[model samples]
Target: MSLEWLQRVFGAKVLQFVMILFTYETEEECNTIKDDLKRNPDLKQLLEKCGGRYLTCNKMMNNQSEMRDLMKKIEHLFNENQQQCYTGEMPNTASIRKKKLESSEHQCGHTSEMESNAHLNLILLGKKRAGKSASGNTILGREVFMSKKSSKSVTRDAAVKSGTVNGFPVTVYDTPGFYDPKMGTEEIQKILDKVLLKCESGPCAFLLVIKADSFTEEEIKTVEKIEKLLGEERLNKTWILFTRGDELQEENITINEFINDTEALKKLIQKYDQQFHVLNNKIKGHSDQARLLLVKILQRSFGIK
Candidate 1:
C-alpha cells in the first residue's frame, strides 16, 4: 500500500533493487534502449547521477493492458512490507549478493563452519503426530529428537539439534504441537519466544511438518493458525515439509504429481509459492535428500543462481 511499508520488508536501501524502465517505439528502429534513456533530457541526467540497468519490453507499448498490469505488480514490490533490516553502508551489486549469501548461513551457532559458510536455523512445527520430531532427526542425520507413536506430543518443550549438511551447519529446533487442549495460548507463545531467542540473527527457514498420507480440513485450520502466528513476513521463509515420504513411494507417485492432483494440497503449496519438500523420515540413506533440501533452503535463503 505505502512505499514506506514496502521499504521496510525489502530494505531501506535502493541497492537491493536496481531495475530502471525505458520505452522503445519499435524493435527494428533501435538495437539499444539504454541510448534512448540516456538521450532523453530528463532521464539522461537521472541515469548519470544514479546508475542502474534498464529493462525494456517491446510489448509494453504494443500491449497497454498488459503493461499497466505489469506496472501495478512491480509497484506492489515497492508497496510490500519489509521483513528484515540491513544496517551500515549502502552496498553495490556485488555487496548486495554477498549479503544474501551471508544470510543463508546459520547464525545461532559459533562453529567455524557456521562462520565461513551459510548457517541455517530451521524450526520444525506442526500438530501432534505430524512427524515434526522425526523430520528434524531426518534432517539432522541422527536421532537427536525422539520420534515415536503417541496420542500426545512427544516433545513437550522446544528442543534444538545442530549438525552439518554439505559443509553448512544447520540448526533444527523441534517445537511442541499446536491445538493442545492442555496448554494455553500464552504458554505456546512463550515456548516459541524462548526457542527464537537462539535465532538472534533470524532463522534461515521454518519447516511446517505434515504427514504426506493425510491432510484434513482440521489440519488445514492448524496450518492457518501457524501462518497467522508467523505473520506474512516470516511465512515467506516457511516450507511445507510433508513427512512420511514412503507413502508416496507405496502409492507409486511423485510428490509433485501428488500435490498437483490433490485439490487442497495444491492450493496450500501455491499459496506459499509452491515452497514444499518431501521426506521419508523412516527411510535410510536420507543424506542425499537432506542435502537436496538444504540446497533448496539455501537458495531460498540466499539467491538462486
Candidate 2:
C-alpha cells in the first residue's frame, strides 16, 4: 500500500503500530514464507540484502533503506483489517459479555447446574519458553501439564486439562509455541485450529501469555499476529496473562508502571481494555493469581461481575 493510502485509512500512528508490529501476510502464509527463508540460507540473505532484485532493480538509493520502507508499508496493508478494532474507539465489555452469555446460556438451557457450575473455556497462546504449560499447571493447581525448561519445545501440540478454579469448572487448552516465525508446521497449525473445540458451545475467551521479565519486539509481534488471527470478536474476549510474576516483584514495579514504560505494550493493554493479570507459574500449589484470573474471565466472558 502507498503511504498516502495508509495515512487515509487508519492515520499515521496506527500505521506505525502495524508496520512495526506484524508482518504483511496472514498468519499461515507468513509462517510458510519464514520457513522457506530459514530452509534456504542463500535465498534468505538475498532477501535481506536486496529485498528482491526485481523490486529493487529500479531503486537508485540505499537498497536496505528502500527495502525497510517497502516492508513497513506492506505489513501495514496486510494488517489493515485489525485497524477497525483500535480506531480510537473502545469496546463495551458489558455488551460483549452479554452477547457471549446469550449463546452460552442457550447451550446450557439456562439451567441452575450450568449457571452455578459454569465452565470457562480458556485457550493459552504464546511463544516458545513463554511458560504456557507452567501457566496451565498453575491454573489447574497441579502438575496437569509438565513444567520444565528445555532447549526445544515443551508443549508439542494442544492438550486439554479440566479442573475447578475458584468454584468454576475450568477447561484449559495449552497450545504449542508458535512465536518462532517458522514454527507453524502443519501439525502445529492443525492443533491450534482444533484447540477451540473445547468451547463447542462457543468459545468464551483466549489467554495470551507474555513473560513479565521481557516483553521484546518479537513478543509484541506475536501478540499482534495472534490478535489479528483471532480477529476482533475473540480479541474482545481475550485477556493478557503475564507469566513469571516473580520478575515484576524482583524489579519492584507494578505492571501498570511497566506498561507505561513501553508504547507497544501499553497499546496492547489498551486494545484489550486493560484486561490483564499476572501469574507466578513457579509457585507450587494453588495461587491467588489463578483465582483472580477466573473471576476476571467470569466477568469478561459471562457478565458475572
The stretch of ten residues in a row with the least summed lDDT in candidate 1 is 1-10
For model 1, how does the per-residue alpha-carbon lDDT over 31-100 read when each residue is reduced to its tens digit? 5665666567756654443344345656446767647765774665445525333344543543676566
Error of 2 at 12 (Å): 57
- Give the per-residue lDDT of model 2 (tens digit) for 224-248: 7777667676877888999878888
Model 2 misplaced regions, further than 4 Å: 1-117
Total clashes for model 1: 10
C-alpha root-mean-square deviation, candidate 2:
21.3
- lDDT accuracy of residue 89 in candidate 1: 51
Alpha carbon lDDT of each predicted model: 0.72, 0.70
Task: State how far residue 265 of model 2 sits from its true place (Å).
Answer: 0.2
